[model samples]
Target chain A: MIAAMTNANPNIRLDKRDLILTKGSEVMLRRGYHGTGVQEIVQAAGIPKGSFYHYFASKEDFAVHALEFLYAPRLQRYAQALGDRSLSPCQRILTFYGELLNHFRRQERPQYHCFIGSLSFEMAEPSQPIGLQVESILQRSVDILAQCLTEAREAGELNAATDCVELAEFIANAWEGTLMRMKAGANAAPLSVFLHQLERLLTPSP
Target chain B: MIAAMTNANPNIRLDKRDLILTKGSEVMLRRGYHGTGVQEIVQAAGIPKGSFYHYFASKEDFAVHALEFLYAPRLQRYAQALGDRSLSPCQRILTFYGELLNHFRRQERPQYHCFIGSLSFEMAEPSQPIGLQVESILQRSVDILAQCLTEAREAGELNAATDCVELAEFIANAWEGTLMRMKAGANAAPLSVFLHQLERLLTPSP
Candidate 1:
């Protein structure tokens, strides 16, 4: 039946589209595109497949859009967190970690394993579009962190020797790697350890 | 016919079992288990499906063994690198990175994305057994690094402030994350940047 129905309703509200994106992101993050099916995504979203294709061109297009959708709110949250005027740059950095940890822990399904990293891993050899999408997100993420680090550096919140761009990439890499360890360990302690170590590194030098 | 063919002659000089695993490891390391098929493995190995089952109980079992086979040599190489008596602890640490970078660059496959990390991303939620195998490898890899760090710490080669265990874990996490970035960016410079930052962190203060 046309390879199963997709959520095909253009008139659908943004909420419905987000719902599809959330469910689709989860499935693709876990089983990957080749392994996931439209039926499964629709079932997870509690929406018909017709509603899905209406919102997306194809599985590949949906995956790209889903990543963008998922990242938008996160980037917004990060920007808000970094913009907090009450907290110092270092304190805001700490708050960022708290927000991320809380965000992941609250998920009923812990499959939001960094869309960029997950898709990059799966699509490295198969889909150039997916890889390009992932790279774009990664670059954006790195850029955001770099901006924060640069602000901190300008404020003298970080060591003067720190290279903002490199440290930003390092933090981004650490976050991705820590996520892997947490998922593989199926325990949160590694994440806690990472944050603890990160805080220790960020603690102002006496 | 069954989902996957599994039969082969037992008397072949080149044990079809070893051949299958060797070829299968190459395929799985590159394409992932779900992304590959028994036919592809058998065809690559020039063996029949019957020959495959003669050595493996199932595809999962074959995967488990293939991973073990692939990783054991790596563990040995790491051990040797960490154990090098010719270099000081700090030098040995740097040597490990040098060796890793060289191996990845010189390999027939320029993209030697760690099999354990790659498979962990693809199979973490779907299969607990495979997940456990990946975890064991990760733990072992970290432990090996920790041992080197401990030796370095004891030898007074690292900054007194560095916690060997935590630093080891950090290094391991950084390396894994760097590999993902390297693959995503299709460039090795990120890895070099990571190692350079790490060298600064690990070097004893003057």
Candidate 2:
């Protein structure tokens, strides 16, 4: 049925696949990996079950793709913010977080903002394919932050003694935690608090 | 069916209920709230299907109770660590995290250590009772930390200018984020990094 449908209308098939991935990302982000079912994704996408299989072999495979779909644009934004040479490295780092704060605030549900963090907690166990994907995405994010910190240190924006790699990982870890609190309390106070404290840590002593 | 089973042996029914809750907590912690099924819990506990409803009204209700069950013991541990008068308040605070780090290390799968953090990301949406329960539990945890920080301030263990309430929330938020990283990396590095950063934050400048 899937082959016949795809052969009849390849363009429609591609559109349906994109639709499933988009909707799947939304539901999975909200409900989590194990919590979401393939049937629900199909229903939400308004596509047939067979189409889901045609687009992806399994739910986990679909999740991997869905994550890539969710992350690709955000990664671009990160590069844009962190890669800008005009701003001081420190400003770039803070600006990235400031923009992220605004992004979180703009969310109808701020708690659902970081799907990667959500899935990391929900699926980063038993060290399966899904877990490895989450680990790699997080590592890449941390690497970007580490690069920014390294530049900041070189420019004398940060303490010369500071360990950029460790600090970057620490910041990322704290940010993820702050996101969890934001979701649990249904408030943005934690994010603001994190920003305040993080600035204090990053600033040079008077 | 539930009423008949309960009437048959009330004591045995109570035991069965406890069994179901215990097993449910384990599976839910590993799989997440929506990912876990009633049948899986029942099967894990070696109980029949009718007994599940006999104990709890719905999956949401079961989850709320399961959270309570998981949290009660941990809360007691926190209280004990935070309430110890023999140590300076700073030592007490550090001791709590030290103990937590050890606990995470002891976990065969450390990613599953913080069930509240996982559930916060998974179920802390406005759609259900589970979210409220998670929110309240997290708040209570934060409150305890705030109280400890307040004591630390009085003891001159923390900076005089520190806002204990906000710092408490930040520490708690950062700790949860650290746990998420620990899970994703499947290692103890995040916990160690959190302890290092948290200690630095709490210490007075030389």
Candidate 3:
């Protein structure tokens, strides 16, 4: 599907920018940053090769923006989910997993979760700059969740002894690893089982 | 540093088969399955495209072998680590993480944790056959660890009430996620800290 390009920088004439990023995101999410070709992006976006160069200085430039474009809203949803007043901290965290499981089951059939993570791993081998951008994007989300855990602890909603930073990192990684296992597993039980065990971990024993 | 390729199969010609798989392993590890080009693999292997096709019917065939090539040793080491009779089951598990942490620190400079979980994420989208191969590799490792955990429980090495399957899954994921965060953080402490916490979880509290 060709999404119409929206210009974020009018002075820069980024008319084809959004189209490139959208198409590129699809390809990269399916493939990966190190594995994708600008030619493929141009072909997928239905833009000329020359037009791709005109819109972005290089493939790396487009990928950095694409990572943000692909991940920003997902991170926002994460923040919102963590802040949900109607749910307990533990419930909200599990709800985030539920939402992700729903995404995995979608007809579009995304094979993985966390593009920032995928790119971080693929790019870590070669490109320092790209790896940093992806890591910062992930860390930002981790920081937000850590803050939520802090708030939950203060509200007497979590065990006071729980280390919020470690817990946040744990939840982030559990989700990340769960997605990988889910895609790799022939069955879906791994995802739900991980979540159930996580709930058991977070819930205080009476 | 280029390593000489050794053929594991006697029926296959050693030089040609090793050339394709060794180079293919590097490309897939560095770029991922879909992101890598057949041309790139052939060039790196210094084999003609025809020679490449002579050994493997398709990229999928090459990828299946590459996935196996990448993970087979790691799996062997994991089994050895679990089967070491000198160490208690809990200590064996801790030693496994310790050994993995050393590998992470050593290769953290050059993006060392190559295949296993990394490629699993990248190929999750396009390479179903390769994905299955990787999944089976992971599942087999998890099964081995689960068995160790079961032994630990039966031998009274852990709390009799400890859920072996869940704990094994958690330990496996902690390593996967910790590698990513440590890579992102550019520090090894997170990996060690996770191992420490895991040991605490595994120990029998009086």
**TM-score (chain B only), all candidates:** 0.85, 0.87, 0.86
Q: Sort by DockQ, best first: what order? A: 2, 3, 1
Once superposed on the true structure, which residue ranges of model 2 sit more than 4 Å away at CA?
Answer: A1-17, A48-50, A106-113, B1-14, B48-50, B106-113
Cα-based lDDT for every prediction = 0.75, 0.81, 0.75
- Write model 2 residue lDDT over B27-86, tens digit each, in one string: 887787777888888888888889888789988888888888889888888988889999
Question: Which docking category, incorrect, acceptable, medium or high, applies to candidate 3?
Answer: acceptable
Candidate 3 lDDT tens digits, B1-206: 12334444544576678778887778777766666778989988987899888778888788888778767887898898998989989889988888767876786463555576666776654667877897788778888899999999988988888888877776676667767776665667667667766776787756
Candidate 2 on A1-206: residue-level lDDT in tens? 56547586777766787799999888887777787899989988988899899889999899878878788787778877898999999899888788778887886766555677767777767537777888777788888889988999899888898888888888888888787777777777788888888887788644
Q: Which stretches of candidate 1 lie over 4 Å from their true place?
A: A1-10, A13-20, A37-57, A99-112, A204-206, B1-14, B29-31, B37-40, B102-110
Which run of 10 residues does model 1 chain A get worst, by summed lDDT? A1-10
TM-score of 2: 0.87
Q: Which pairs in model 2 have colliding backbones? A: A177-B177
Which of 2 and 3 is ahead in lDDT? 2
Per-prediction RMSD in angstroms? 6.0, 4.9, 4.9
lDDT of 1 by residue, A97-154 (tens): 9767777677654553666666777665466676677767777878877877778877
Cα displacement (angstroms), candidate 1, residue A30, comes to 3.5
Candidate 3 residue runs with Cα over 4 Å from true position: A1-16, A49-51, A102-114, B1-12, B106-110, B204-206
